[model samples]
Target: MDWMHEHELRRVNQIKLSLPSSGEEALAARERIQKRIAARRAARTPAAA
Candidate 1:
């Protein structure tokens, strides 16, 4: 079980390391997603309120 966990962790780390986005691109994507999520939440709240 421990070995399986270690293998999975290594695989995940490798994939993360290999991803194409530079730090700025990742941050920009995250910010865009957060803004979209916040806008959706705001839209839902007033209707429910």
Candidate 2:
């Protein structure tokens, strides 16, 4: 009955898909965050040649 429709299921599945569900996925997410932090830092300072 309810399983026939995908309204709520679709929303929940989207949330689940966005989460890091494994160690490798979690590591990748962490690396991405670190890269963002480094980029911000790099943007705020003068570079030396």
Q: Write the per-residue lDDT of candidate 1 for residues 1-49, one digit (tens) a residue.
A: 3666887989988998888769878999999999999999999999999
lDDT of 2 by residue, 1-49 (tens): 4664688888888998888679878899999999999998888765641
Clashing pairs in 1: none
Evaluated against the true structure, the overall lDDT of model 2 is 0.83
Candidate with maximal lDDT? 1
* Over 4 Å off, model 2: 1-21, 47-49
Off by over 4 Å in 1: 1-21
Number of the top TM-score candidate: 1
TM-score of 2: 0.49
